[model samples]
Target: MFPKTSLHTLFPTVNFTEITAIDMSVNSDFFREDPLHENLDLAREKITKFQNKYPMSLLANGYLEERAFYNTPNFERTLHGVKEYRNIHLGTDFWLPESTAVHVPFDGTIVIAHDNNYHKDYGPLLVLKHETETAPFYTLYGHLSKESLVISPKGKNVKQGELLAYLGSEEENGHWVSHLHFQFITDLLNETENYNGVAFPSEIEKWKKLCPNPSVLFEEEF
Candidate 1:
């Protein structure tokens, strides 16, 4: 079970309604309806173009959206001799400028802060563990600035509304557009440095239960 109240905003003093909601999923009107066929840089350029279109407003992508952009080999997995593709995103993304400060939404202890520096990977990922009346749950912040590691290392206690990390640049944040991939995890599945931010469409039901929609924190449906 999760708490229903007293959560803070990840960003300070920003109006959530003012933020623009964009569909970056497969068959999206914003991006191509089909899977993109290009290199990482080219794919990133497409995101940049969308960002440029909404320069003044914050952009968001909904959780559980099926994205065709993750067509790269990096998203492939060999499971039991069968190839599995993880394209259904499990987290909500906030597209913002580089160096944007990210704050803690609830009182928690930093459980993990590691740099997963592979191409199109989640760079400088941070996981915070929060204790509730029933049990403890975890929150993950991905594509964060490297300085986030020094500021909020593992085993550190953080308060709500406290600065947790800043957004990272493209060169450092997995070579993608600057954005925060925020997710909620009821269980880590024994993962340490990284957690699955996306899942196969067939196994989406399981992942949806493990990583519940984070929109409750924002108090809006993206």
Candidate 2:
């Protein structure tokens, strides 16, 4: 969906060339039958490796991990509540250390900011609504620090690449790795601070229209 739209750089503060892509396919140790991602201890070790390797951030743009992103018991309780379902990831996962600066993708307004804390959930989330003459969309940054809980006025205008928020710790950042769950949204569907970051395989088409592929922002350089 993003290919048709001319999207601008999301983080003007950071150097895009420094960002690196991480492969979570079967080839990687993390994707093996019993991968490191399945356990918190091993996951932390891997995160430390990423922190040392990529100072900018670790990007997991197109990771479809066998339909388990939302299928876990924790995710089911948070998103579905009743139905036990998991969905494939739809946005670029920017893995950064705690307090990493999160910038406004484009000229936009603060639509929503709240703490959506749940294990393996988007703990503290922010939704920035952008409406340019040529481009109109929203950027969702999840797993932000508690400071993001009270970012600013709901309708305040934010410039492109402004210091928007900072990354939160694992305790506040949904018990997963310390990273930003960045998703692009074309429609809010009445969702304010928190929205579905995972999409069931059956609903990928619908979610795609609402959340465009954010990897387009880095495809050229990577």
Best by lDDT: 1
- Model 2 clashing residue pairs (backbone): 70-86, 71-86
lDDT of each: 0.81, 0.67
Pairs with steric clashes in candidate 1? none
lDDT of the structure predicted as candidate 1: 0.81
**Shift in Å, residue 26, candidate 2:** 7.4
- TM-score between model 2 and native: 0.78
lDDT of 2 by residue, 25-47 (tens): 43555544444255766776766
List all candidate RMSDs to the true structure.
3.1, 4.4
Model 1 TM: 0.85
